[model samples]
Target: MIRIGIVYMATGYYCRFWKEFYISCETFFCIDAEKGYEVFTDSIELLKMNIPNVSFHAIKDKGWIINVSSKSDFICSISERLRQNYDYIYYLNGNFRCLKSIYSTEILPEEQNGYFAALSFQHNRYKSPNEYHYDRNKNSHAYIPFGKGKRYYQASFYGGRTDELLKFSEWSRNMINKDISNGIIARYQDESYLNCYLQDSEPLVLSDAYGYSDFTHYQGEYKAELINKNQYLGTSLLHARSLLPVSQVKLQGNLGDQMFGFAFYCYLKKFWRDGQRKTILSLLPEGRRTTDSLYGVFPIDITDDIKIVEQQCKNLPEKKIIKVTEKFSSVFYQVEDFNAPVVVFDGKWQCYQYAEACEDELRESFQFSLTHLSEQSKEILNKIRSCKCSVSVHVPANTADSYNILLQKIISDNYFERAMEQMRISLQCEPIFFFFRDECPVEELWEELFLISQCKHHIITNNSFSWWGAWLGKNTEKLVIAPKNWSFWKDTPDLLPTEWIKLPINIDKKQLNNIIGQQILKSQVTENIGLYNGKMGYVLFFFHCARFLNNIWYEEYAEELLSEIYEGIHWDLSISFSSGLCGIGWGIEYLVHHGFVAGCTDDILSELDKKVMEIDIRRIEDKSLEHGLKGITCYVSSRISSPRDIVSTLPFDPSYLNELKEACLRLNIKMTQLTSINDILKGIKTYYMKLHKGAPLWCELYCVIDKIEKM
Candidate 1:
């Protein structure tokens, strides 16, 4: 008979999320009658009451240090204590919910002395091998080994044979003790030590299927299967303690000892009350609008109109407003319960309503000014002001040709001429056409709006910016001309005011030149504003003490040497050590075989240097060549075998490397193929001196040279 035990701990606030985990686990175990399951926790009485059939073991507080470090120690101790009774022991974190029954057969191997662990989904933070550092002086609980690339296992769900687990626990405990004695802690408490231990141990690695955290949002094959079949699976962290804000969790008025319930209640009450009283206007910007495809409209900046809307709201006595600035979808999940009446101000509101709302105070607030203007800009402004009327034209470049044709029809309908004629008759000023084009400075554009506002008459486009500018203009007798159709798909009746003249969409193009008399010259005031594929070099430093030694002095020396070589030259430098586990060997082999200068061969280095010089000289003659030139160099330190073996060392499938090779060949890019420690004092000194001088010292030059010569 197989004996399996699931152990967890719940001390303080851990109980809140633990409830779900506990219930889920109990439900799963109850369905499987053949499996003998036992749960061990500090809250045994509570568990026994909640889950009647399951056996509960109460862990008495033995006055052990209660920190992240102590938590691991406690887990190890429990595993050790239960080793004799259970053949297979599984330790699950209190926050981990078992949605389905994970049979021992499914997870554990049939044979004994087998260890199992799952890779962490939170690979960016804890699993980054490059970022692993443990200093004795620092009071932290996380450690990452030097020069190791990110490959980590989550300690939340790890189990093995009773004897193997006990031994693993003991070894981890010893490491912790050593760290504690030296007044230091591992980077991630138990998780760090577990990773350190596993680096030297062979464990059965499980995919993210077994240990799915909240961060793993993508429903992979396993997760999809669980969902499709309506089966329950494991979920690691339902609620992350670090992410939850303290104020959000703090209890206000508690009905009982339940803090989470009380806090949630208080949160809902406060936000709901505030939401109920306010007239919530959700202004979805063009980027935020989800119905853009349905409407067949181009994106427009509604920032100015938003201000107008806010000003209009302020004028109304009963408009108790709460403006939600972001997209509705993003914030809806957070405050879904706060049921407020939402009004999306999509630029189809009545113009007179806005015009009447724009009081003296509103107009003053909407007025724009430029603190400084260039001479060319000043001259352009003068020319625009000299015109009897200013026109704002909207061309639908991003939309279909049909939309542009409609715009062209409006432009050719003698609209600008008629508007100018009207302005000349009324305001007795000559109208000058002004429109914003690409590369127009923002300040100058705002100034154009200000200039348009000053105009006695305006020819407006089917744009929110133009509408707002015309509305905000100081002219009392302004002739606001707008297109009949705001969009081809929809008729915008409320877009134009009764006072503003609406031009027909299909106006005659021949009648256009008659009213204007002369051709309106297009604005001549123009504003103009405006690592791969090259000779590469690789420096390989083969130092025997590269992996084992944590001496800061060597690191500092390496960094200095790298900086010196990298400062003046446009070389893309990478400093790596002779570490097999870090995949440096694989990187070097790929580089060397692909015709990249390894710096080991004098002939190759000289040729590369000559190419670099030639490129520099060519760049002086043709600036266009310099545009394509980029840094393409690297510093490699590892012993590499043949290209085939190097490619095999990658964690991924061998086919991926083949695809990579194919891609490199297609792109005409070279891959360089570039090891292990010897504690020779003379070799070490020589390597250090060579590194300090920024000189490449190849220990195994023949290996790469021989491979390259054959190629």
Candidate 2:
């Protein structure tokens, strides 16, 4: 017959859950005194009401402490009882209820096993220091530790075989009694002392079912438990912990917090004594760790209504079991072939933490190291860098602080004048300047870059998003520069193999104090800003568009022109009108009126459709009418699609397209979503004939003005 014992503190709160736990186990005896009779009676009543296998011993006036402090009393309680009668002993706490049922048929023969069993569970939610385990990877389970970064292999101890297990239990009892008599108690009481002293004592690392417990309140640690001792050796199909009986949970009033705390304490101690920590790598047969052997209990099946208990079994890990010390009442097994997943050492072994003495051999034998890159990552980075690009600059369109104010400031003329002066000094070799950020006063920034620096400025961005701005740029041949690595999520993996120069730096300090240094550089320099302006200077613009830069002003035609320029020069553009627009002259109505040649703007299509006199007919039977319409198209297209046009800086929300399209339909002016500059240029070619005949002189003069504007 298999014997199981539950040693509870008999605290008032754990009475109910304990009752449920008692009813779930088979041939189990409770170890609380008669004063704990209320809790004990509750268990007996629960057993009679539901489960019928387990029994309880209401010991009067016996205080058995099980913590980091009290080891001897715990050992004596078991040693004294096991010597009398009992084939197997399962230690359970007061607070936990069985999620499964244990039966006598599950016990393994004593001849086939040595001593321990461990159950694994689901690890953690995040990289929480208190819960995460380092070795827990894609294929393995995670275990939480006691203090910080400490973890223990969870198990439920079943002192199997009265003849063999009792011998160790007696010895464990004697040692504790001796310590008590001598008044010798270590800081870490029974569990800690037993755990520390049991180092070379018992045969450790036996495989079993997965057990779980809430260790935060009681021992202040999280752990797993073991239940199926007989099934640890070989039976793969039977790898499961018996479920606890739900009928055993007493549905009474609230079972106060203390009972919950103590009940969990009991569960923790039961596993601490019986379950041994072994790495998942060693437990697998032929080096294979599968989720099949592991099982979840506490959080899964345990509710306010269920009673859980352990199932006894004989299958154990195939390894040599060495008995360390023959002094404890509960004998621990030392398995030579396995290693503890985590080992807690007395301050003496500080440097050699996380790893055991034999870890070096394990690493050398397995040949494992951290892996960083994949083939896909290498391919993507290379593609982005190898493209020929004229522009590469970060845009500041994100609403970091005061997005409205920054947009206003960016569009201001004074800011552009100052920014232009800086750019004039900075651009020595690179002829093209790239711009990216939130939608800003693009015309103002463009005018300044063109007029002040006398160099072509290019804007590289996908919509108004700042992240898209930086990412869309494919100017690997051009100097790639940005404010800095501003995002915490962004990592500078050696992903981009090419070395692109970072431009946010001060160049003034490098100017030599003597004329000889200047003379040598001046003779070799073909182009210099000082040659025109006669001033030694440069500009370093920070890429962030936060609230601090809100003092700037918006230029008049900035938004209207920017939108047109974007449509003309780029392959993709989405036109939309909105009533709830903010900052500068950014209303949807104003943009639509300025952008009417491209698309119409209105809340309802009925309103704009009524206003449409006629579509600008590309071919009319009368040459004069056809010629007049073509001229208008040419003029509108050229001005709107000019590369210097300014547009709004608001970030593009991907979902805003439908409403924008609806607004365009209101005026019967269908908007064209251009994918590239080539499309708009093709549209320009269609209107070339009318432009030559209807307004030939003005169109020719306008083209000259466009050329002079750049100069």
Candidate 3:
């Protein structure tokens, strides 16, 4: 006779699911085999009860989250005894009920060239490769890149022979502990690790019928199904902890900010109640209709038309509300537990911890819409991808006006320059540096960020835009360097991921002397912004460190830069975009945007628009976005809602396009710069479609994962 062992854990309140599970296993699980039940739990009374072949071992409760991740390790500790006594061993989910007989052959793996492990099917079987919530945190041992895997397996029910199962358990246990040490709990925790293991493990893929749950609404021949926990635990969180049946999430902030709330939604849905659906309380961004595919966690009900949340609350019985703002931003261990039947999270919710909890989902949903890029940007992207070694250095001058100026002290131009130089020296190949200058020569904002993310490594400021771009980057060996000091109180909040290197800003000798008014200062801020001194290297040092000098220094410098620019605008004679007066005047707008000087560069840039009329549009062959006629025209016309569909980045004046049209009309060329951009985007989509299949990154800004199945 074949010997079979059922390894199970039913600690604390989980014992409530034990009675039904025990009866089902004894009656319907491997009837012909000689069976023994190995139970691990905290209930001492279970040992005294004569429950057939069941033998209970007293186990200290480690909580659900810890227990779920370490379940494999627990079995591994007893693997020697299990393998000796039984011909086959399987660990079934504690909450699932075996409704009919499941034979040993159905659950066991057969040898196929090498040892094979058995894997279970996710409730919802079919999903696009990008739709699967693969752990995106490069720091986590569970991370699986976007295109690496095709199957999304459910961890609730899976098992194999004792020897092969031990191999998987040992590997999984080590990865889980490492994640805990790094303070990372991957998306769906244990399940995320299982998917990571199954990515390359061409294991025997079991049918969805074995792990079926009524909540999935997936009709199939069911041998076993996950029973609802609410029937036993009621509304108490002692069983689930940190997860409660949520009624609705109250959303706040602009569209980009509100996207942070989805992570909280993931936690709330962990232990859901019947008739409960993921619901949001705020109005969505204008164009994102319910019909369209959202970033991730799509098909959720939007109670937008109702303005008053209290009025909206009247529909549901729960009156209590929990708001998660910067006040609660210190959350890193886990989302705070809610005791109420209906949990509500309201506020800016700028916490990265929430994003980390559901990082795979966030990466899928908020995948950057790359189709918004220009043809020139796509060419640069191909070059970045073709090169094995590349690094992006992002130093934001725009944030100086908005954030507290004291925050600027934490980073400097010298910090960026040295970081780039060190990367070049350390890497085997000469690294191509893509430096994000103070004034972006490129017109589109998302294109600039999309380009930065494609690079293999990154150096980011305290800004959120770059923080997201760096986090979304899929490079396996990617290195991200960020400034240690961020806030005025000197507290380094849980903003940057722990895996990223945090270094203090190192000011160079020239920049250091510029600050503290030392005698060794290389050049005056006034002289650095001269008409001729605006060369790349000189401008890199001056514009980057300019914020180090007082606001008055930039105010005087920008004023002087534009005062001389008016004289050069008409007589400079050069018609080229990058080398001409047009480039100098274009860069000054950044100084104005940074709050250095107000309204100083507008008239000079406006007058330079007339200078484009003198050049022949047909003769100029350069079509690159950086220094081409297309780039210049887009800059002059102001990049208004190109393909990003978001509001304009530069805040262009209404008459800007009309002014450009007049210039183009004088030369008899149709004002077709926007049409040219759209044409280029079509060609780029053809290329991405070939690479990503039907799911091209450029089709729409968002990937439509309208999967509404109960995950």
Candidate 4:
């Protein structure tokens, strides 16, 4: 027996709309994650009404979201249902439409049994190597137009042996595990993976004109050829947007949840204007008009002003009948055959109405903002004197799709600031209040004028800390905002309904600031390399030994002091050893590769001299200093890869210090003559200490300082 299931999370508009469609299936089931008392009772009642020959099962578990992982305990229950001698199983997720019956003359009966047959519409940018391609233009882009004046739909189907499918399932689980570990899924990647296995099966590819019963509302002139079949032998796959014509049932109550209810009614009204009859075939009680169809019952009421709806029937040779019922609430239609010549009425409601509804919801959810009358910003200047300016900022925290949208919005907003100014003027306001969702750090947002505007003037943000800082001044009011269309926060408090300054939903911002801010904040919270106990212990041990070695005179033990200096400094020996392996030539190669100097001639010397001055390598002399004037000199310098390239080793710049003293005499360096001498002596002392460890000793300095008496 073929067992098919229509899985739904909860009762909503789509559920009620597809009631008859699900009932027509061989086997039907509903999976409710929440299992709320009201939803459970209603679902059980609905199941009992349709469950004579059909086997129905419901699992009340909160594992729907955990389906992405290869191992889902929920799948186990589903697998159990499949093992009960089900020859075929078709799983249809909610919010889907059945456009056409799966039976077609083009496919053979043998190919239709034992496996799954799914339909996919190709609009994705990422296409696989083996997928069919046709050329429109010479550009090799995915989903570009193929061939002349005609396009073909390419898809992979999976429907074969049950054992092979079970094997594919195991493989799919493994691939899911690998994908999770590597983080390699790029949108619809699971579908892509499924396509890979199905590719070898050489599945059927529909022409653009083929009849498909899947989702997203199939249109055009070819839909009639696929429907009105006596029986469907194969399963039809669809996207999540399909809606069907339900002539049998007249829907009432909150029509918001029904799939394309109002929108379909509008289309029916238009069809009625085109002289089409309203048909209903169900006698559902409590409504004005009763009607009946092939399977269920319905009632109708005509509400729109387009035309006075009239019920009609076209009796066919096969005893098929079309019934229409009309009243004040809604119109109902029903046909006798299981496969009726139904008009495709998908995608309900006007876009503007949807947008306005979202706007109103947003307004109710957020607070209002005050605009300064004198602000110079064009975006701010166009608001009415008393009217509030509302702007919403979006920050997609973890979702990549949201991130991409956010980046685009940020770029567009920055580009359109001038237009925003003109728009503000057009709106007749002195100042416009802008709202932002700040996800980025304030420190990294130097280039973001949006955030700067809030800091300097009248603006509000969802970033609570920054919002308070912006609203600190005593003279102005603040605004907070939230999204209008989405009420489920998905565990994010940032999206919750709270008192915030309201802003118009500007999807253009995309919430990039949130990402930048989080990154900056993360960096701030996680920085401390040498603070580890082991590292600190090593540092203290090295410091004590270095202090002990300073007591030795350099002239008496220059080689030993060099070793001590090497031991004293914590050299990152990994790089040092790597450098050592590459040898002296590697150091010169690095300098040359970096464009530091050219040629073998004294170019390197000149650059080194310039760097020496830039780094402030200096001289010093003082008896009170730890290392007194000795047979050693020191100079401050950065690391050099090779010792072979370095020629001169100088400590204190005695000549530069003497020159500075004379320059100070000429009213130059802000020091008394005696203080200048002391400064030079301090510099000499520093140079002497450094010479004990860092710099190569100058032979002349050792000779001169070594010749001096201890006095």
lDDT by residue (293-325, candidate 1, tens digit) is: 111122223353344345433333332222333
**lDDT per residue, candidate 3, 1-711, as tens digits?**
888888888876788888899889888887778889888888877867777677787766645655677677788788788888877677777787888898877766777512444445555456676877788878889998888886887777666666777777898888887666544566677788878887876676767567677666777788877777666565444433323233455554333345555555554444232112223345554535432223222344443323334443443433444444444443443445554434555544555666777777666666555555678888888988988887888876553232223234423466677667667766778888777744554235556667787899988876665776677688978888876654322243676777887766543334333332421133333233322223321332244334544445643443544555544444454544334544454455444545545564445355555555555554555654334555456445432322322442433444655554554555444444332322333333444444553312112111101110101
- Model 4 agreement with the true structure over 1-711: per-residue lDDT tens digits: 233232333332223433544442222121211110111112554546554434444533212121223222233335554444344333333323334444433322245432445444433223543243432222211112332222223222222233334455566555655444432221232344455455445444433233344442555533212232122211121111111212333433222212123333433333333112232222222534321110111122343211211211222222222333331122223222223323222221222222222443322322223332124443433442334443323332332333223334433454234334534554444445444443344322211222333432333222322332232222234333322322111112222224432333233323423433333343233322121111211222222222333422222232332233234333232111111111112223333343332344234334333333332212323222122211111111112222335564332255654543443344323322221112323343345445553211121121112222111
Clash count, candidate 1: 29
Give Cα-based local distance difference scores for all models.
0.41, 0.28, 0.57, 0.30
Among these predictions, the greatest TM-score belongs to: 3
lDDT of 3: 0.57
Kindly give the stretch of ten consecutive residues in candidate 1 with the minimal lDDT sum.
526-535
Off by over 4 Å in 2: 1-9, 26-85, 101-156, 180-184, 196-198, 201-208, 214-711
lDDT comparing candidate 2 with the true structure: 0.28
Query: Best to worst by TM-score, what's the order?
Result: 3, 1, 4, 2
TM-score-superior candidate, 2 or 4: 4
Where in model 4 is the C-alpha error above 4 Å? 1-17, 23-50, 53-76, 93-116, 120-161, 181-186, 205-711
Full ranking by lDDT = 3, 1, 4, 2
Taking all chains together, the TM-score of candidate 4 against the true structure is 0.24
The 10-residue segment with the lowest total lDDT in model 4: 32-41
